[model samples]
Target: MQIAIDGPAGAGKSTIAKMIAADYGIIYLDTGAMYRCIAHRVLLQGDDFSDTEKIIKLAQEAEIRFEGEKVFCNGEDVTESIRTPLVSLHTSDVACIKEVRELLVAQQKKIAGDQSVIMDGRDIGSVVLPEAEYKFFLDADVTERAIRRKKELDAKGIEKELASIKQEIQQRDDNDRNRVEGPLVQVEDAIVVDTTGKSIDEVCAAIKKYIDEVRA
Candidate 1:
């Protein structure tokens, strides 16, 4: 079975994806993290986003691996390093590059083959796993999503204003939805779930109800 969850950031896609993967004993592939790995690599090599050649070469060479929830880039463990605010801000810059997306999408598809996998990202349903048995588009109000992102940064002791977070989320939406390759999209067949004003368990239960009925 394959489950594809696509959503803008901070819609609880990652958290809920982890839960669903655990419940089903399947692999939880964090596709966003793969992009973040390349972003983090570019940052280390000089924090240059305009250098598409360098970025593409890095993508071609990056060895991204997931052991449990940790992510490794090349030979180093970048699990927490890639989650820093700076890396988060630059991830989409690299993701929008067509070559980078193709490189990473191939890895994502290979990882999902012949396995019970739950993958979450901007374009999983539309590009990475169109044949997935179950697909969902999770969305929430922009302000609600920004508030969620603020709390996450706060927990990590990274102080960021709520307004700034909201602005970043908006920009990311524009980029993801407008990108030329592997753009973020909701397939017509995908089940749409608005997570606004809903608790994680509530959202999970609602999605599982649909999946369970079909399975039974």
Candidate 2:
């Protein structure tokens, strides 16, 4: 079974996906990291982010592996490397390309087909796993999401102004929503969850309830 979770930034898709995957004893795929990995590679190669063809070629050659929480790219461990602010800033662009999305989505579909998997990203529900058994669109107020993102960055020792963080989040939202290929959207059968002020446990409980109902 595949569980597809799509959401805007800081809406707890990743956190919830990790939990649900563990609960279901399934492999968890962080699809966002796939784009981030490509962005990270582009930066490392000194290629311009606007060089879409080059980026696509790089993606084709790239070897990405996920072992639990560790991520490897081309035999090099990049779990920490890809999380840089530079890559984070440009990942939306990388994720928007039809070729890039197709490449990654194909890989995601293969993995999901082989195992019980929980995957999260902008297009998982709509494009990567349209026939998934369960789908969710997680969301929250922009300000709340910005604050949550700030907290996560703070924990990582990455400091930035709140205004700038909010701006970045909004920019990503706009790009993801307006992109032509598999833009971030609510799937037809998806359950929407607003987590503006809810605790993680509360949100998980609600999702679990839905899962039980769906499975029943």
Candidate 3:
């Protein structure tokens, strides 16, 4: 069965999706990392973000792959490189491009066909895998999400103030919601999980409960 988890930044979509995939022994796809990899490539080439054609070409020509927990681009391990704040900003821009979304959505679909997979991203449930047997939309308050994001960046030694992180996340949410191609939205059939004060295990267990009900 295919599982699609969609959520905004720092909403714990990735963590929960990874947990589900591992527990079920299925493939886990991080669709956001694909866009980040393209953004990283664009930055390396010193290309302008407004250059949509160039960005689309770069996305098409670049080879992006996931090996275990590592992300590779054109035979290089760029797992850490793609997570930089600069790439995070550019990724929002790249993800808005129509061609970029089309290319990545196709890739995601191909990888998921006839396979049990858990995929997470801003548009996974709303756009990429609408027919997924199980779908979830995770969300948290802005302050809570900012705190979670700050903790993540701190672990990476990338420091930013709480206010700045919250503003950046708000901008990202606006961009994702207003993007022309595959805008981020919660599908009607998806189960919404508000994770504002919940622990990761609590969130995972809630989702797993639903999955278990469906399986039974």
In terms of lDDT, the best-performing candidate is 1
Mind giving the per-residue lDDT tens digits that candidate 3 earns over 7-53? 89889998889999999999999999999999999999895898889
Q: Each model's C-alpha lDDT?
A: 0.93, 0.89, 0.92
Q: Which stretches of candidate 2 lie over 4 Å from their true place?
A: none
RMSD of 1: 0.7
Pull out the clashing pairs in model 1: none
Report the error of model 3 at residue 185, Å: 0.4
Q: Candidate 2 residues 144-206, lDDT tens each? A: 998988887899999988889889999999998999988989988999999999999899889
Cα displacement (angstroms), candidate 3, residue 82, comes to: 0.8
* Candidate 1 C-alpha lDDT tens digits along 1-216: 999999998899999999988888999999999999999999999988999999999999999999999899888999999998888889999999999999999889998889889999999999999999899999999999999999999998999999999999998899889989888899998999999999999999988899999899
Q: What's the residue-level lDDT of 56 in candidate 3?
A: 92
Per-model TM against the reference: 0.98, 0.97, 0.98
**Candidate 2, run of 10 with poorest lDDT:** 80-89
RMSD of 2: 1.0
Candidate 1 global TM-score: 0.98
